[model samples]
Target: MQERGALLEVVVLHPRDVPGADEGGADRLFLVNDIESGGLSPEPGTVSRLCRETEIPVRVMLRLNDGLTTTGGELSRLVGLAEDYLSVGAEGLAFGFLDSDLEIDVEVCGYLADRLPGVPWTFHRAIDSALETDRAWRQVRHLPGVDAVLSAGSVRGLDAGCDELVERAAADPEVARLLMAGGGLRGEHVPWLARAGVRQFHVGSTVRPGGSWTKAYVDAAHVRSWRMLVDDAVDHELARRTTPYT
Candidate 1:
């Protein structure tokens, strides 16, 4: 990854959205077959197809099911899926699991990290479920293989918690290394989020046409609009950062 302030354009794409995302100029892709349950592991063929089809990088979700917490068996399955995804040429992996007390399951996450040291890893929003989020996020930030955090701050969603997330990022340059702002982001939110030190923005259901609530389909135009909005936001943020203060 680049330094704390570099822009990373990432979009969560269902298998159905590949063509649209590709045509619409996405910089990278987070491929998930099951978007309704937050996100989950995708089919091996799906990963392979995306890797084969898209020149941009691809990352796959590793959660076997929806809930943030996982059993030992379920974690193993996640590991298995991670391995499968990497084998099929996924550029990175995104996932997280918590223990009963809702803290980062260090043992589990560490094991996954150790299992795939060469590839990049992102601790997903499941970190929001951490019982004491501040401590949990701090703990995970120091882990050996964690690269980025897909977070909406500590609260349930981005709108309410983004300022807190910005505070956390400003407090810790390490967290800023890959602090990706996501969760219910629309085009208008990009400029503000960019100003708050969010270097990456993750868009999911809203990127579809007909809107996420109306069972929107994959429309390249939707992705194109998002691309334009995000680019404008990043450019403005960069200019603001470099401007001389009189």
Candidate 2:
């Protein structure tokens, strides 16, 4: 079982990975398709089957094409797709939007949030690619139903962005609370992130055997190792919080 107060989310590209992820202690599954395109939306039938099979909460991706901008008939199509995913039992959604200027496209995001009133969502890595980091964070903080903001602090992922993530979390309480640290996440990053107050973690190819999204399946043992690493890190952070100063 995963430790309380921390979440370990694993990506599921196919239904076959479901049992191993669930059995290996994933708290939730980020269901997506076409990993090569950085994860576009999955078909509703796929979502339905995975939702039916896995007890873990499933957050389906809502992007139709590569990049963050959506407009015209594409927006309409996405709204309908959102409904389809919900109808099939998706517990949450993962999406992000940016204008041509590379800023948070609040209008588009708000429109979708309005249509799906109570559904929780995550603002994905588009925040890292925004024109300004602080401005994007400010915009997303108030968006309705956005329970988390997935970021690696830079577009380049953890190796380049880890320090920035730690600093941001320490400086801003809301960022810390809503931040779901991910993108090239590794075991060493877990302890630092946990200590900095990140309670949620997302893993993609990391949980797969040989870390190959196409060649290898998600391995139960690999997932379990991540579960243990995150759980232990969170446990230690909690202990440190309650420990008396010398």
lDDT score, residue 134, model 1? Answer: 79
Candidate 1 lDDT by residue in tens digits, 16-126: 567877787776788876677787787887788778777778888888877887777987887788888888888889888888888998888888888888778888888
Error of 1 at 14 (Å): 4.5
lDDT of each: 0.76, 0.91
Off by over 4 Å in 1: 1-14, 213-215
Total backbone collisions for each predicted model? 0, 0
- Best model number under lDDT: 2
RMSD of each: 2.5, 2.2
Angstrom error of the Cα, residue 197, model 2: value is 0.5
Model 2 poorest ten-residue lDDT run: 1-10
Clashing pairs in 2: none
Clashes of 2: 0
